[model samples]
Target: MAVELALSADTVRMIVQKARAVSESLPDTYEDGHEGDLSFDTEKLENVHHHDGLAEEEHDDFSESELREIIDDLNVDEATELVAIAWIGRGDYDQGDLDLAFAEARERSTSPVSTYLLGLPLLPDYLEAGLEALNL
Candidate 1:
């Protein structure tokens, strides 16, 4: 089956690159297998507690803000597709479930897509994995 993305592969790659810079700039505070993890899987992004130590001021604002701007600039359809890709990468949904993931992303989104995505501990990795899964 052929899957199409509202967001281009180049754009996704750029986001992943920028997000990786942001990820590299931040301190590593996440741990694996914490109780009450909000993420879908255990080993993937792991527990949210790892992000507890990272205050807003702790991250590289320039890089993060750049990424935020890029994400925020995306149309709702593109943003929703981005979320679906991440979900696929994070194992919340399989490649064949792209449509379902997109639906869930759109239906479940309550906050800014940028805010929700940037909040993920392993955004770059997940996005990269998502790209690979989609064979883009």
Candidate 2:
């Protein structure tokens, strides 16, 4: 079955930055006036994997899958960025890895900002690269 992917790369990056900003702006939503609970889930990651070309890989990276799930399940648009952050938390890739991914993503599409942000500080250079790539 063909899946429909709705987010654009620019949109993804903006969403990610927005998500981070929101989190930082209100570290404790519960303490603040934000009514509602925020949590992460694994099923979302599975869905991301299924859509983000992970399902075709021969080797299974369950941890990445789980990370993708949590990111995908978030109530924010910056799911890719969150997923990248989770990868860093898992020690899956370094800054260089992120940079490489960003460069590759930039070459693949016009929306490098989102892909670069999605990769996050997996490589700090990605931020600059993403900005330069997107002309932002």
Candidate 3:
């Protein structure tokens, strides 16, 4: 699918790296027999969750310049989804909330990647709405 926003390769790489790091640190959601049974420490998870909450509070503090720099590197669709996921990670929303958002997106035939990413954390409703607005 064509990306609505235009992002630089480096920026995209950074976003992907961050997503991977977060995914790796999270507890395994698969069954016991799954090939990768990586699990996270409960204490670490708590700490990370707490920190992520704090990060959310600071999200809006990002200067217009900083926002532009980040947004400039992403396609409109990606940027829309990424920004929402970032807000969610920052503790703006909960998993159940994201579930509702995902359901809405699926009804609209949004990108799987966008759905997957948004489903991960506390993304804002606006981000999910943006995805729904996309041609995908």
Candidate 4:
């Protein structure tokens, strides 16, 4: 019951859980300039790292695809709301400033929403905090 959001709080929670799984699966640090060089283990969202000498094409494997699919499945409004929640959670805006946050999220979402959101570390914590702040 996220009163201020377009999506259900439960739906947002599920999305955050999926995003957290994606974040937890990734390596702790990507080289600042070479952010594109990343890959993951064959299992679930865990043990991700750079495999030496792997081709760039090879790097776009399952874990990322799984995350993309998870986010891709959401309706446009839900996706937009999730981004807003993340922005609030990350302290980019006060809970009362949700309209501005939502506007920024939509304007900034030029890339695949999943790629953008998954790139954020601590997404789950941020989202959870935002939801609490909203008293969802």
Candidate 5:
């Protein structure tokens, strides 16, 4: 069965792309524990003076900020569905239980949807799985 959404497919696709970018880049940028080290690297500092700008790999602020903006722009129902979709994707709920998922998403939400969604490290994968499950 095809799942209909008030939110456009293009919007969801764009979100998926952004979420994937952020998720993929997070480990190297945030979890590596070697990015902003300023200990005793005099030679590295010499090379840094020659560089024009900060390296892209050093941060994912753009993608992550864009994602937060996109989610923040979504209406209440749209955001609720998005949460439900992620839940479904993560196997917390099934396609047939979409309405139930929606209810839970709405009822259980204590923080902003974007905050909740962004906390999930596998958000992109879950969203993709949810979309496929819904045959969207």
Candidate 6:
């Protein structure tokens, strides 16, 4: 989608910075039994991170509830744009797919932003790449 962004580069940058800070503040949600430096294998990290047998990753130090509140504070347009950025960053859509991605983001947003975003380890990188892709 060649549509213009409702969010500016500065705003997206701010979001990326905040998300990175939050990720740093949080402890490892996954426990891979090994010690020393943690290898961030995204798929493995998410897959094994379960409470009981269910797929429920743990949240530590970082207040997901507070994060949710932070994301919830944004206007609907801002939120939808954020999700679109994530989708681009994740390669679910290319930069050309902006409008379609944004529409899908709006449709797929059945959960809170914090829950959706906090799950991704490379969110800041993705957001940054997405902004670059958009030339913003």
Highest lDDT model number: 1
Off by over 4 Å in 1: 25-62
- Evaluated against the true structure, the overall lDDT of model 2 is 0.36
Q: On TM-score, who's better, 2 or 5?
A: 5
- Identify the superior model by TM-score, candidate 1 or candidate 4: 1
Candidate 4 lDDT by residue in tens digits, 1-136: 3456546677667656656656767654435633222122223322322222222223334465765665555556656677778778878787788888767766665555666667667778988988887778
In order of appearance, the predictions have TM-scores of 0.72, 0.22, 0.25, 0.67, 0.71, 0.65
In order, candidate lDDTs are 0.70, 0.36, 0.37, 0.62, 0.68, 0.62
Local lDDT at 126 for model 6:
88
Q: Which one wins by TM-score: 1 or 2?
A: 1
lDDT of 5 at 54: 23
Q: On residues 76-100, what C-alpha lDDT tens digit does candidate 6 reach at each position?
A: 6666787788778778898888889
TM-score-sorted candidate list, best first = 1, 5, 4, 6, 3, 2
Backbone clash total for model 1 is: 0
Query: Residues 17-102, candidate 3, lDDT per residue (tens digit)?
Result: 44443444444433553322112222322222112122233233333234333333333333334544444444454443554433
Candidate 4 is scored at a TM of 0.67
Clashes of each: 0, 6, 8, 0, 0, 3
How close to the true structure is residue 116 of candidate 6, measured as C-alpha lDDT? 65
Query: Which has the better lDDT: candidate 1, or candidate 3?
Result: 1
> What clash count does candidate 2 reach?
6
lDDT of 1 by residue, 45-133 (tens): 22222222222333454477777766776766777788889888999998888989988886775566776777677988899899999
Please, what's the RMSD in Å of model 3?
14.6
